[model samples]
Target: MIDCAFKLQEQAFTLRVDHRLGAARTAILGPSGAGKTTFLMALAGIKRPTAGQIHVGDQVWSDSDKRIYLPTHQRDIAIVFQDSRLFPHLTAFENMHFARGAKVTTLQIRQVIEALELDAFGHLMPRQLSGGQLKRVALARALVAGRRYLFLDEPYQGLNRELKGQIMDFVDLWCRDQVEQVLITTHLMGECSHISDEFMVINGLGPTFLGPLHELVQQESSLKQLMQIGIENSLACQVIANECDFIVAQLSATQLYVAGHAKVGEQVVLKFRAEDVVIAKEACSMTSAQNRLVAKITQIHQIDGRVLIHLDAGQPIYAEITPRALSQLRLERGDDVHCLIKSMVLRVA
Candidate 1:
């Protein structure tokens, strides 16, 4: 278990968080400036807390009362920042070698390099590699430390859908077999939900909720709606059939066609902006929309001239529409509605 109780006081804001996280894998879900990155910095020993303590198991990383503080390099924790902090002058192989903060064997280094598919570009410098390759090299370096704790801040920020899935697969395997504790941060709720077992919702007021993903639906209905403001709605599904320009995916019992070139039986997350969803009382014929699902209205929330409708189409889905449409359609809880989606607008991530 990892315990942290800290207060950060900056010129523009004051943020406080006190919590004990026991989960093996936890995702810090928050907006861009909700102090997620700052919290990670504190836990990684990059920033000293003004008060309180940070403990991982029996090791004490920081204690304000005793003036006990360990610097970043001394801590047995590894971090992969939002930006790939690779040495521009050094080759990719050299970068990985330089991050051998712990007593890692040469065989272990070779295994990590191969696991991340970086064997081919080991001799290339950071400037010569593409953005995705650079990200993989940074990840390889962190894994070389073989630490018990790992912190990843927006690890999938620049990668394409295929690359993101590959990275996520490796991280999932690491959490299962090697890492004792892993904490990742992302502004997009849908991106990391699959890999994380639990999540903490942090906003302007700091952390508001932290618990299992299953309990999130029942315990914090309004908070979930609020978090969806800047994020797209995502549903986890498996591709059942691939038809060149589009593919059929199954989300529970409901199947929808998504425009993406995914192989059959591949797991993917379908993401679309809430505004892109069109609600209808009855299924429309001869419409240009490529996908439609019948779902029940589970929630209705009004914010900033728009009404956010939460639906249950075998799984949770959200749609944001104008207040005028809400009045015109006269939507209500428990009402059956058809959600229209254009396949082109759907992002398979």
Candidate 2:
């Protein structure tokens, strides 16, 4: 468990956050000046809060009433910065070596080096390493030092999507193996969906939301304001049945077939882009699409020569179509339309 309640007044801005989080993994998301970094700094003991207290599990890191504040290095937490802050003068091996302490064993450090695939370039200095290599070294150093919590600030800044997924997968495994809590700040929605289920969203006004991804995605206004065009419809679903490669899921009262592998009764989050949904006047049985439902169009939005249709079959779903197609089909509010969805386009998380 983690608890933090503090009021921070910076030179140009001020923020007040008070929340308790019990999730083992959480993603911190926000706009550019949302105090995401400031909140993290306070949790890591890098910044002193003007008031209130912070407690991780049974330990107290800060308490203004008691005049107690822990120093950064003494907090037993590891932080990976956006710039991959490695000692430029030291070799990669030396950089990782310096972060090792009495709490973390030498064998543990060796494990991190191998896990991050840093054995080949361990002897090279930070200046001679590639962008990916530097980032891996930074992650390895954090694992070697992090005895409790791990903090990541934009860990996927310079990497491509494929590499980002690979790095995040490894980080997930490492945290599970060590049974540690990780708090990461990321701007990419895709990474957040892949890495964490619980999240916290903050702005200049401080924390606005903190809960499961499914519940948070249901907030249309907040979701649109934070993600903008990247917003995808999310549904809390359960696997009812599986046939070969096809998995049948139930979203509220609506049942849909998806292509995935999951055990019966397993709960999952179903996500698909609005543009992938095909809106038609009637369901086409001859098509290869596996899921088709009749829904009423509740709202229609036009942007960039395209239309976004919000509908409700059982739960809310969004479908996007071109303006020309919309005109040809004559779709409007309160119109009943068939939403044809392909199983392959569905992403289960």
Screening candidate 2 with a backbone cut-off below 3 angstroms (N, C-alpha, C), the clashing residue pairs are none
Instruction: Quote each prediction's TM-score.
Output: 0.82, 0.73
Q: Which one wins on lDDT?
A: 1
Note each model's CA RMSD in angstroms: 3.5, 5.3
Q: For candidate 1, what is the TM-score? A: 0.82
State the lDDT of candidate 2 residue by residue for 1-349, as single tens digits. 7898888877756768788877888888887677778888889888889899999888899999999998887777899887898999999999988887567777888777766778899999899999878988987888777568888877767766455655666687778777478888876555553547578877756346777655665565455544442546667789999989878998766688998778899987777877788988976789898888789998877754556678988778878788899999999899999988898888776
For model 2 the local lDDT of residue 264 reads: 92
Candidate 1: clashing residue pairs, number: 0
Model 1 root-mean-square deviation: 3.5
What would the per-residue lDDT of candidate 1 be over residues 1-349, giving only the tens digit for each residue? 8888878775555668787888988988887778788888989888888899999799899999999998887777889988888999999999988888556788777777766788889999999999888888888888777888888888777777666766676677766776788888888765663556677776646445677654554544435534463546678899999997889999777788887788899998787877789999998867999888999999887765667788989878878888999999899999999999999888776
Best by TM-score: 1
Clashes of each: 0, 0
Error of 2 at 164 (Å): 1.5
Alpha-carbon local distance difference test for all models = 0.79, 0.78
